[model samples]
Target: MKARPAFMLVGAAALTLAMGACSSSGGGTGATTPAAAPTTAAAPTAVTLTVWGPQEDQVDSTSWLPKQEAAFEAAHPEYKITWKNAVVSEGDAGKTVQQDPSAAADVYMFANDQLGTLVQAHAIGQLPPDAVAQVKQQNSDVMVTSVTGSDGNIYGVPYTANTWFLYYNSSKFTADDVKNLDSMLSKGKVAFPIDNSWYLASFYVGNGGTLFGPKGTDETAGIAFTGTQASDVTKYLTGLVKNKNFVNDANGAGLAGLQNGTIDAYFSGSWDAANVKKALGANEGAAQPPSYTLNGSPVQMKAFAGSKAVAFNPNAKNPQAAAKFAAFLGSTAAQQAHYDMRGIIPSDKSLASSASITADPVAVAQMNTVANASTLQPTVAKMGNFWDPTASFGKALLSGDITAANAADKTAAWNTALNS
Candidate 1:
């Protein structure tokens, strides 16, 4: 399987407030008799901190969260972290929070793409200065350029280091048959999340193109489908479809095909490792996407990297404490714990050499591939609007609704929506 980029988009909020109310009465120093001294202060009433994220369900009941909760509780006896699992329907977690604000978890675990919307909604808050410093000291790389928002405030701490990978059911292909993209395709058709434009970006780049050209240096920075790049990318994709090597079933039926032994391979993200394991029943293999031959060398596919981080609710009652927890989650210990249970890669470079991760050949190889060949970029709200239309173009190309020459026109229509 080849790697494809996947974007997690969070909606921004409008306003954020601070909510901290004392839960206990203070004791007087001079008035009370010797027999009436304050007794243990009731353990600060055990504040329940709420947390939200799409990975909540992935946190194994016996393995991960319970241990983390116990550690956090032992460290901060006054706080009790409450996990609230939220669904990321339609690629956005904002809808989940919008449905209920108070019930919305105080801490949100969000995709890198959705940070903008969360910022706009004012649902996320800046971390405390000390906590930010601590996080910087704990995991500088993931924090340095990874979790910062557009406004220059730190919104979240990365909980999962995610990347895309190709997952294949070996039963569909013999050892000799699964050599390269063309060979794999020659054996059987491949499936992709055509509905997911971010995932499709890998296919675009694999053919020597990009969604947006080089950042900062190119005027097209933050723009999608500009230049002749998109046309070239579409042509390659059209060729794949025309050759009957790929199918476009945007509703995940294509993936279902691979799972059911109808297809050989599928493009999926690292986050889907567990799902793929379940689908393939422990007899699957994972690989990096095949490369396009450029200058006599096979240039591997450079897909998008998807990351999830924990952000504080600006309106939370315990900002400082929330910040502490956020920082703790990014620590190497916590990251390793998460990887142990979730199969996600760690953002911290130090953990790259950890025994738990290295013990698994598939994980080690995938992480190395991601580190060497991957691109990370933020996705705008409009990109969400572009997904369906772009997927429609993929379907058109696959179904012959439109010729390769006209793919630009279809893509241009999607770009128009993206820009709108």
Candidate 2:
């Protein structure tokens, strides 16, 4: 599913009132009728700090943006933050920003894939040193390393912590039926987006394969795959599709299936849980993707980690104020508030165990699973180019027209596209 970005800033009315009240209180009481309490000149109108993100069709104004904006404005009373809405119709945020710096917004919400591209292009500015230090002190466990660019400078503040989970129809499968892959397959059908190659990676990794070796290993650093491992993943995926164990619902067919009680499970991100629960009923069960056994123990799945972070445009008109606002966003209180308003998990380790997050039993269990499993590095500019190729290859593979060897060749074609 595509992500829709929403940006909101509380109006200056509250601040205006607060300033006015302060002025009146400080002024002499001799002036009856308040002698027009010196108009506390509106907080120095900082350069309109423009921020853009894809429009969210689902978020209600009262729920997500307004709340965040009110909190941000309340904390920073000296500057006016003007939020602009920009939608990315094609390519990623990095490419969109590079297309026109002036037209590009001062602040942008980018998915993980867009982060590297923005850093590589030098389109993003580093977090002010003081801001970084403050964030570190507040939440020590949130590694600044995750948001650091290839240039070894921090460019963004981690916002959303996303992972894939198995959203199944409770009406279709019982808890006992979903204990393992075999039982799941035997009991009900599974569905996911077939156009994305990452879905394939999720399945392969869930079954104990890695796109890259360990945490420190670079995915593009020429990691080799054994023939046996390749065959195993390919065979497992193909067999699932061929046996009608998994369904590719490219045309909302899966959702229809879900609504009709035909499909058993759907693999999707945590953000979709709310909608999934609404559709399947609150009583439905959610679980982490099943693990594949290696040796004697169950191995975890490899899922992509998508982060939504706030970054300043190097060409922002109000660099200092914008920087300050960005820093405020990374503050402990702000991070927790954001998480509370939206069901998004906070990147701050300090808030990771907070009651708001852990209070939801399902969310807590899924998060625990994520902590145990490794995450795939988010897509950057280079990886964005691979999305189409991977989707095409996956489509062909599902159609029974492409073999594992051909799919490998298709992957090579994707690499070539990235270079081009």
Model 2: pairs clashing at backbone N, Cα or C within 3 Å: 113-379, 113-380
Count of clashes in candidate 2: 2
Error of 1 at 382 (Å): 2.6
Best by lDDT: 1
Q: Relative to the true structure, how large is the alpha-carbon lDDT of every model?
A: 0.61, 0.61
- Cα error of candidate 2 at position 385, Å: 6.2
TM-score of each: 0.68, 0.67
lDDT of 1 by residue, 1-420 (tens): 333223311111111111111212253333322223223434454466776545553356565555665677678766655554444522466666656555566666667666667777777777778767755665434334456665567767765546666778777775555446666777787776654666766655555554444421122444466555666566566676666766665667756886677767877766666667777875677776666433344546766664677677776777666667767766678778877776667676677688887676457546655565566554544344546666666567767766677867866775676556
Q: Positional deviation of 199 in candidate 1, in angstroms?
A: 2.6
Error of 2 at 221 (Å): 1.4
